[model samples]
Target: MKLYTEEWMKILEHIENNDRDYKLFSINYDSNYWFHAKVKGDEVEISNAKFHENSCSIPNPRKISIKEFSLAFPLYKQYTSGVPGIRYKMQKRKIYNSSYIIALIHEIIDDYYFRFSNILNK
Candidate 1:
């Protein structure tokens, strides 16, 4: 159930392989820090931005490995929960159902833990 584990990487890879477009955005309190991810077909891109409220800034996207994607989950959770004024959006409504990306991640994690427990029981 831990984040950023090998099994988590596998789940991310499986998601990336699926033919769909996904986007996730998380912003911290005051909007000083944020992370965004976009997945299309088999490619995934991630971007992080930090700036003062009065400043103009742009998020530079970069290709990221599945492992890096998995590692970012904890940081995203921390910022989204611990920081106030958090704003999050997952998946574009036009391209996919609202919150579908978040649900997909939970489903993958649940499936992974279930299989892992089965293995341990054997």
Candidate 2:
């Protein structure tokens, strides 16, 4: 179960239900909760991928459709972090849990999507 509910997920579901070709996002999340994916048809990418912990490593970005993008849990955590909702108490007030991180990321991506969609469709 997710730590919190997201209305954006419902919108994504609606998009998928209405279109097939628009459902091929490419984000790759590993066991550690890090992700790496590039927006299709764009040279830019967004990735906070962890190559190898305790070693010199680099992130590998992959191109995926915008429809395939998704947000997952525990947005950020240390090696031995505590429970989800409870851990928020130990951290700073600016960010609480996966909910806050997801919202922030969603807002950023949504902004970029709106900004580019107008140009791409025209």
Candidate 3:
């Protein structure tokens, strides 16, 4: 698998330092960022699958399979605060009991800092 770009890594660092509200997303065919975590109690969900950077089509989902979603618990614990405590009453995919979701806050934060840092340096 390709490594994350300097931009991507920078975004991750920002997310680690600051846990403020943020939204991060990429066009289809872009593999600069990814989140390999589980959803349902037993089901694993890998987001940011194959690069799909096309602006016309739907955003690509980077996906990966796992023997058990639970195996990624440590990653989740280190990354996220906790599963969204409140559940939506609308239609939602069934998630693993302990499946951890890595929110993309880090990516956005990193991107933000990278841009801001560049401006300051300039």
lDDT of 1: 0.40
Q: For every model shown, what is its TM-score relative to the native structure?
A: 0.33, 0.20, 0.22
Model 3: residues >4 Å from true position, as ranges?
24-122
Whole-model Cα lDDT per candidate?
0.40, 0.33, 0.33
Compared with the true structure, model 1 gives a TM-score of 0.33
For model 1, residues 9-103, the per-residue Cα lDDT tens digits are 55556656654333332232232223334564444554442222332223455554444444444334433344553223222112222122333
Model 2 RMSD in angstroms: 14.4
For model 1, state the Cα shift of residue 15 in Å.
2.4
Specify the poorest-scoring 10-residue window by lDDT in model 1.
90-99
* CA displacement after TM-score superposition, residue 74 of candidate 2 (Å): 15
Best by lDDT: 1
Instruction: Give the 10-residue window scoring lowest on summed lDDT in candidate 2.
Output: 19-28
Off by over 4 Å in 1: 1-3, 27-61, 82-122
Ranking by TM-score: 1, 3, 2
TM-score of structure candidate 3: 0.22
- Model 3 worst lDDT run, 10 consecutive residues: 86-95
